[model samples]
Target: MTTPRKVTSLDVAKRAGVSRSAVSRVFTPGASVSDRTATKVREAANALGYRPNVLARAMLTGKSKIIGLVVAYLDNHFYPTVLELLSEALEREGYHVLVFMAAHTAHDIEDVVGQILDYQVDGLVLASVALSSDLANRCRASGVPVVLFNRKLEAEGELAVVSDNRSGGRMAADHLVSLGRTRIGHIAGWDGASTQRDREAGFVEGLHAAGLGMFAREVGDFRLPRAKAAARRMFDTSDRPDAVFVANDYMAFGVMDVLRAELGLRVPEDVAVVGFDDVPSAAWPAYDLTTIRQDAEAMVTITVSSLLAEIGGSNVTPPDPLPVRLVRRGTA
Candidate 1:
């Protein structure tokens, strides 16, 4: 039986009337190849079905060009928005994203990360995750560049692309104070996560700066029902706050639902409310939530670019605290 001939670089070089060395140099990056010869080699290679093995090329260059994208709690809109930007930005940089969803717990990542590391990813972007400092240290020690997105590392010298959480919290406080609302309370995110902790601290400091005392706060774990429970507690108590700032818009929406449906309270009039993240629903006519807007798209873009740069051998360090802004609406 006659078998089809296996195409090789020599065949391509012969067909293109160029030396095999020229064909090899044309495929290899930073290798000297004339423009006239490169065109001929590409055309010949295309006709001969001689596609280069990307894995082998990457191994030769000591770069995998695969990005590990770790997203915890994608149930929140913020993570999904960040993920969409990350996928697009990474793709544009000739890198593929190996996505992993960490179920809402630091413990869950222990098992999931094994797979991400197995993919031989060039770099990693942790999307609002609360990785333990020890695990993060191990990741760094293993020679993978890790960049945190929308979250900060507790330890020093760790790379991160994080929003100005303290500033965002202060912004929320300033807006509430401007409305002449006192007795401000906070509905915070997960207690262990850096974003939640920093936002809570910033809000507290901001209220202090405005000459107001923080009445009380409850942890929502960045969830709806938990936020509702916290808000319900505030409503049920005899001594309750007049206005509240809930960290993240999803929780804020939950707080609003409780205020309107369960407690029958009017927003801004009865209990002025604010939230963080400023998710798409924040600007909707129904919610119209006055919240701190963390530019999810921009954050994702910068993080992806930084990670790709590191993967491609660029010695780039991401900004310590990424920028966040205020998106004022009607809740407060």
Candidate 2:
């Protein structure tokens, strides 16, 4: 038996009694086509069961209409929301998202990014994952535009969109101080992450501005288990913190669980708690966590617009940091 030949646009144009360019315009987004001509093209396409070859179209136009997204981890509640917003925003622009998960090791990141490049994506978005300078240089040399979402790389010529985490940290500190927390401590996230450093710095600045200093500090590494362990050490000490500001809501949940379930400490009574990233779980009755809201929708919108601007041959300046707000709740 012989395989069937694929349907072509020319065949549809002949069947519809229209020019081949009319059929092309009907399938091409943003291309001009009359309503009657589009209707006739669609009917002919449906009757002939014809579909445009996207790969061939991409080869001809030098555009894949695909954006590559690299993410380090999705366990955090924040990133899942970011992914959803990105997908929706890109779809509206007639683009699709291709996700790539980079491992912890540099070698793994290089390898995975190389595979993404193989797909010839029109642009790339890195979410909380930094590419090595060498890999970044390679991407630049290849002429593919990249935008960093919720993180920043130290390399030049890279665009980033992030919340004003420093201000959020200051807000958290001021809120705790207003609550009359004398002995305040903090559970920091990963040491190397830029977000962690900025938040910690702002927290310290806010504390000093209020004539107070951090009582104790622990590294959570943005992991629940590590946060729990850090909470144990802090609470077990004789001078436990009267208030604790966790780096992110995921770690905050672990810290709260350790304080309430494991140590039988009453939240906001024994120790007030605050967190960053007003994740959905933060609003639950059990947690009701006071947190800094990082507007995911705004971040996603800016990121997509910046990326598309670059892809459209426009030089994009780094966007100003998005604002964050403190969402007051029962915890603090």
Q: Residue by residue across 1-332, what tens digits does model 1's lDDT show? A: 99988888889989999898898789876788889999999999999999766566676676667888888877787777777778888788667788888864667776777678877778888777777778887887778888887777667766787788988888888888888888899988888778888888888888999888898888788988899999988777778888999989999999999999988889988898989887887888989998888887777777877776666568885476767888878877
lDDT against true structure, model 2:
0.90
Model 2 regions lying over 4 Å from their true place: 1-25, 31-40, 48-50, 104-107
Worst 10 residues of 2 by lDDT: 102-111
Which of the numbered candidates is closest to the native, going by highest lDDT?
2
Number of residue pairs clashing in candidate 1, backbone atoms closer than 3 angstroms, sequence gap of 3 or more or interchain: 1
Each prediction's RMSD to truth: 3.9, 2.7
Candidate with best TM-score: 2
> For candidate 2, lDDT tens digit of each residue in 1-332?
99898899999999999999888889887789999999999999999999987767777677889999998889889889989999999999999999999854557778988999888889999887756778877887887888878777766777889999999999999999999897999999987777898899999999999999999999998888999999999997667999999999999999999999988999989999999999998999999999999999999999999999999999999888899999999999
Clashes of each: 1, 0
